[model samples]
Target: MSKVVLVTGGSSGIGKAIGEFLQNKGFVVYGTSRNPSNYKNSKFPLVALDVTKSNSITQCVEEVLIRTSRIDVLINNAGAGITGPIEEIPEEEIKRNFETNFFGPLNVIKAILPEMRKQGSGIIINITSIAGYMGLPYRGIYSASKGALELITEAYRMELKPFNIDMVNVAPGDFATNIASGRYHAPAKEDSPYHPNYANVLKMMDDHVDDGSDPKQMAQAILRIINTSKPKIHYKVGAFMQKFSIVLKRILPDNIYEKLLMNHYKL
Candidate 1:
């Protein structure tokens, strides 16, 4: 039987691309959306899911298992983005971002672990961000959330190793998707001290997404990981600079790397 793949947040963007690509490749693909009815034209079946909600996560996993009887691959792609000066962003919004980007994926994995354990095999891929490798101005909250997930996956990999279960992180740079429309932007108040820089950075961020690489590239990277016999713990997909930025951070001194980032963002 073809592998059964479950992609959270798969209704659109990178998740949608992965689902469609996998389905075309002969895998049984199921995507998730908060409102399944909204995606009547989605290429693969979309099940209802609100990643931040535990009950919704449970229901979605159960529904998929009922139909497929097994889930060979779990793609924790559901995430939310937030942008604002760390001090300016409301505490609640930061928490909410973590709830979606971090906790949500954990819950989904929890729900699916038992079945995968029963089958004696499974692969879990967490869709993180290149920004997670380093903090970016006005996007601290988003960076922190995704970065936390990256670390968590490292721990999970070792724990699941004996069970023959694999977990990896696939961090993508900007991709042309509707993520900008869905992201929560802390209002840039004209009277606030950060208004000018924050506003400029926000615009730059959106433009980057608008000009980002095709989501299909992410899908292809994912397909490669799924097919590999022993996948690496972390994979990055993006332009040369974006992926290289991570390498530079590792080799460069703290102050120098910070300077490079400041120059890039014009901060």
Candidate 2:
């Protein structure tokens, strides 16, 4: 029997690509979305899942387990984007961002880790973002949420090692996706003072997405990770520039790195 794989946010974008690729590779792939009805003509099964809700997550796992009898890999790919000047971003907006980007994956982990532990083997992949490594100009909240998820992935990797389970964080740079359509824009009003700068930064972000790496490439990277016997704790998927940015952030002087980031976004 092929290994069963469960992926959240699989109705579109990177999640959808991963599901399709895994299914083509002969993995028993089950993909989830908030609305399954619209995920038409899918090659893999589409299940309804709301990762932010504990009951919803639990039920989704149960549904996958009922159909496949086992879930060998669980990929948490559901996330939301937020943009605005940090000082102007509302507290509720920040919380909402964390609810989707950070807590969502953690909730899924809580729901599925027990079963993996019982089986004594499994893999958990949390789809984070390259921005998680450093705070971005207008995407501070989104960055923080992903950064928190990445740290959690690291902690779980150590904690779950003994159980023969692995947890990894895949941090992709900007990817060709519709995530910008649903992104939360904290109140940067026309006369809000930070408008022009924030608007410029938003435009820069949009351009990056327009020129972002292909999601299919990310899917292939994920397949490589899945095929490995002992996958690395962190996977960075994107163009050389994007991957190099992470390395630059680590080795460069703090002020110099911040300057480069600010220049890149024209902040």
Candidate 3:
């Protein structure tokens, strides 16, 4: 039987690259999007899924079930960003971020675990972020969402270890993707709590994304892991700064790291 892989948010960006890479390796790939019309790429089995909605997830899983009868792997690569100060973002925005980034994967796991448990072998790959490690300025909500994911992944790995289901997290520090552009921007409040500082941090994030790692390289790395018999529970990919992001969090004093990050984004 051919192994099957389903990649959420696989219409474009990193998710699309993962879809393409896995297809070349001979996996039956199913890439998902909210609206089939919104996706321009029709290379794979493009299924209908909106991570924010449980009904949508159920529908997509149903389609996968009818055809494949078993899913070998699930890549939860669907997520959005909200770039703004923690105190400034509205409660609604935070809730929505959690819904899509945190609960969405949880919902998918719920729908698919029965199948995975029955099979006695399956993999759940989550594309988390380096932000899950250290909170970034103007990204409290986004960071929190991914942090929640890290915890969720860890817990699942521990509990499911004996069940033959593997849980993995790919934490990318900075990547060239449409993430910044796709972020949900709440309308700015004029002369409000967060203005120029918010604007500066957003710009810094944009600058990094533009010069970040090549999506193709990241895709290849994922393929390498897929081909391996034993894959690590977590893989962190980035340039020097990403290594620094973690090291600084550990060795450096909190005060020094705060000043360093602030200086990195200083106007």
Best by lDDT: 1
The residue-level lDDT of candidate 3 at 141 comes to 82
Better of 1 and 2 by lDDT: 1
| Cα lDDT computed for each candidate against the true fold | 0.95, 0.90, 0.85
lDDT of 2 by residue, 96-198 (tens): 8899998888889888988998888999999999999999888889999999999988888999989999889999998999988889877658998787888
Clashes of each: 0, 0, 0
Candidate 2 wrong stretches, greater than 4 Å: none
**Which regions of candidate 3 fall more than 4 Å away from where they truly are?**
188-190
lDDT of 3 at 265: 74
Q: At residue 222, give the lDDT of candidate 3.
A: 79
Across residues 180-244, which tens digit of lDDT does each residue of candidate 3 receive? 88898765566867777777777778898998888877778777776677788878877878866
True-structure RMSD, every candidate: 0.6, 1.1, 1.6
Worst 10 residues of 2 by lDDT: 186-195
